[model samples]
Target chain A: MQQALQQKVQKAASAIAQECFAMRVRYLNRSLTSIYDEVFRPLSITASQVNMLVAIITQQTLSPSELGGILNIEKSTLSRNLDRMRKAGWVEIDSSQPGRSHTVQASEKGQALLLNILPLWQKAQETTCTLLGSERSKAIREVADHARSEIMKT
Target chain B: MQQALQQKVQKAASAIAQECFAMRVRYLNRSLTSIYDEVFRPLSITASQVNMLVAIITQQTLSPSELGGILNIEKSTLSRNLDRMRKAGWVEIDSSQPGRSHTVQASEKGQALLLNILPLWQKAQETTCTLLGSERSKAIREVADHARSEIMKT
Candidate 1:
C-alpha cells in the first residue's frame, strides 16, 4: 500500500510537470521576456513599456481603465506605469477633463521617442520572428488568439 | 513633410501593436497564471510553488542555480521563492554541504502537500486543455519548446 501510494505520487508529479499549462507558459514568458528585455535594454525601455506606448499611440486617447483593458494589465500596474511615463515625458494624462477617469495619450516627446526607438523595435521584432521561425511564430499567435477567445467565453 | 512623418509614426505604432511577441506572451502568461493561481489558491500554494515542489521532488536534490535553470526563473526570484518555501516547511535546504551552493529538496511535508493538491492541479490542467482546445494546447507546447531551444542557443 505504501509503494502504491508512492507510485501514485510519482505519477502525479510527472503529470504535473508535463501537462501544466501555467508552468510552461511562465517559462516561455520568462525566456521571451529575457530575450526582448536584452534586445530593448540599449533603448532604455522594457518590452512591456514599448507595448504600452504603442497602445497609447495607436489609440491616441484612452482612459486608464480602457488602457488597462487594452493592455490586459492590472489597474495598479497600469496606474504606476502611467505615472512613470508621465514623469518621463512620454505620456500626458488629462485628469481635469474627466468624469471619474483620466484621458491618456502620448506626448510630443513620447511620439518623438517612439520614432527614435522604431528601428530598434523593428530589429527586436525581426530577431524574434527569425529566432522562433516564421511558422512557429504564426502558430503562437494563432494559439494565443484562440486561447484568449475561449478563455473570455468562460 | 510633417504629414509624412506622422504617417510613419502611425505605421510604427501599428506594426508594434500587430507583431509584438512579448506582449502577446505576457497576456497569455497573466491569463494562464491567474487561472492556475485561482485553482491552487485553496491549497495554500500558488501554481509556481507546485512547480518548485515538483522540481525538488523529481530531482531529490538540486542547487539553487540548477533549479532556477530548470524552471527558467530569475536568480533573485528563485532565491526569494526558495526562502518562502523554506519558511512554509515545503523545502529543505542543506547549506552545510560543501561548495558555495546549497542542496534543495522537497520535505516530507511538502511531498504530502503535493499529494493533497494533485487532484486540484489535474483539474486546472484539464480545464486549460479544454479551454485552449487540444490542438492549440499542443501547438503552444511545441512552440514553447522550439523557442526555448532557440533562446538557449544564444
Candidate 2:
C-alpha cells in the first residue's frame, strides 16, 4: 500500500510539475525578478523597491494604505517595505497634514536615486525584452492589465 | 536646480510606472500568487511551497543545490524553506547516501498533502485562467517558457 501511494504521488507530481500554471508563473517570476535584481544590485535596491519608490514619488504624498492599494501589496508587507525605505532615507512621513493619518513622500535622496536608477532600469528592461521577445512582452502587459482590471472589480 | 531635478525624476518615474516590464511581471506574479495562496490558505501551505513540494516529490531525492537549480531559488532561500518543511514534517533528510552530500525527499505527510492540494490547486488554476482569459493564459505560458529557456541557456 505504501509503495502504491508513492507511485500515485509520483505520477501526480509529474503532471503538476508539467502543467501547473501557478508553478510556471512563479518560475517565470523568479527568473525575471533575478534579472532585474541583479541589474539593480549596484544601486542597492531591488526591483520591487524601485517600483515602490516610483509609485511613492509619482503620487508625491499618499497614505500607506493608498500605496498598498496601488502596489497590490498586503498591509503587513507594505509596512515592512515602508519601514525599510524610511530607514534608508528614501521616504519621509508627510507631517504637513494635521490628523491621525500619516502620509509618505519621497525624500530628496530618493528622488536622486530614482534619477540614477533610470539608465540601469533601462538596461534591465532591454535584457528582459530581448529574452522574452517583443511579442511575449506585449502579452505580459495585456495579462498584467487584465489582472489589474480584475483587482479593480473586486 | 532642485525643482528641475524633481521634475525630471517625476517624469522618469511616470514613464517607468507605465512601461517597465519587470514591474508588470511582479504585479502579475503578486496577483496570481495571492490567488493561489488564498485558495491554499486552509491547507496551511503556500503556492510556492506546493511548487517546491511537487518538485521534491517528483525528483525523489536530490541535493539542495539541485533543488535550488530546478526551482531557480537562491541557496539561502531554499535552505530556509527546507527548514520550514522539515519542521512541519512534510519532508525528510535522506541519510542513506554516503559522503558529505545530503539529499531531501517528501515524507508520507507531504505526499498526502500533495494529494489534498490537487483539487484546491485546480480551483485556483480555473480562477486564474478565467481572470487572464484564454488568450492571455496562452501568452503567459509562452512567456514563462521563454524565460525558462533563457535560464537554461545561462
Candidate 3:
C-alpha cells in the first residue's frame, strides 16, 4: 500500500514536470522566432516587427487595444512595440483624440518593406512548414485559435 | 506583363499578411500562459515559474546555461526568471564558482509547493488540453521538440 502511494506521488511529480503548455508554447515561439528572424535579418526587421506589420496591414487600421486583443499581446508590449515601429517609420499612430486610444496603421514604408520581404518570408514559411510538417502546422494554428478564444471568454 | 507581375506580387503580399509562424506561436503562448497563470495565482506563482520548478525537479540539478538550452529559453530570460525563483524560496543557487556560472536546484519548499499545486496544475493542464483537444496538445509538444532541435542545429 505504501509503495503504491509512493508511486502515485512519483507520477504526480513527473506529470508536473512534463505537461506544461506554456513552456512548450514559449519554446516553440522562441525557436520559430529565431528561424524567422534569421530570414528577416537582411531586412533589418525581427519576426516580431513583421508580425505587428502583418496585423496592421491585415486589419487596415486598429487601435492599440484592439490590436492587443487580436494578437493576445499585453497592452504594454503592444504600446512599446508600436513605439519602435513608429520610430522605424513602419507604423503611423494617430493620436488626434488626445485622451482616447490611438489608431495604428502600416505606413507606406512598412507596406513596401512587406512587399520587398515577401520572397524571403515565403522561404522562411516553407522551411518552417517543412520542419513542422503540414499536419502540425495546421494543428498549431487551430489550437492557438481555440485556446485564445477560450481564454478571452473570461 | 507588368500587370500580371503586379498581381503576383499582390498575392504574395497577402500571403505574408495571413500566415505567420511567430505570431501564431506568440498568441498560443500568451493564451496558455494566461490560463496557467490564473490557475496558479492563489499560490503566488506564475505558470512560467512553475515551469522552471518542474525543470529543476526533473533534472535534480542543472547549470544555468544547461537549463536554458534544455528549456530553449534565452540566457538573459533564464537568468532573470531564476532570480525570481530564488527570491521566492523555491530554488537554490550554488554560487560556489564565484564569478562564473552556478548550478540550480529546486528547494525543499519548491518540492512541497509542487505537490501542493499538483491538483490545480492538473486542472489547468486538463482545461488547456480540452480547449486545444488531445491531438493538438500532443502535437504541440512534438512540434516544439522538432523546432527546438532545428534551431539548435546551427
Each model's total of backbone clashes: 0, 0, 0
lDDT of each: 0.83, 0.88, 0.81
| lDDT tens digits, residue span B1-154, model 3 | 2666545545655676557776789778777888889989999999878877888877878999999878778899999999999998999999998888798988778877887778888888888888888988988888876676776775
Off by over 4 Å in 2: A2-4, A95-99, B1-3, B96-99
Worst ten in a row by lDDT for model 1 chain A: A145-154
> Tens digits of per-residue lDDT for model 1 on A53-127?
999999989999988777667899999998988998889999896477899999888888888778887777787
- On lDDT, the candidate that comes out on top is 2
DockQ of 1: 0.67
Candidate 1 Cα outliers beyond 4 Å, as residue runs: A150-154, B151-154
Can you list each candidate's DockQ?
A: 0.67, 0.74, 0.51
- CAPRI grade of model 3: medium
TM-scores for chain B, in order?
0.90, 0.91, 0.86
Q: Interface RMSD of the predictions, in order shown?
A: 2.1, 1.6, 3.6
- Give the residue spans of candidate 3 off by over 4 A: A1-10, A148-154, B1-13, B97-101, B148-154
Question: Could you give the CAPRI-style class of model 1?
Answer: medium
Give the worst 10-residue stretch by lDDT in candidate 3 chain A. Answer: A1-10
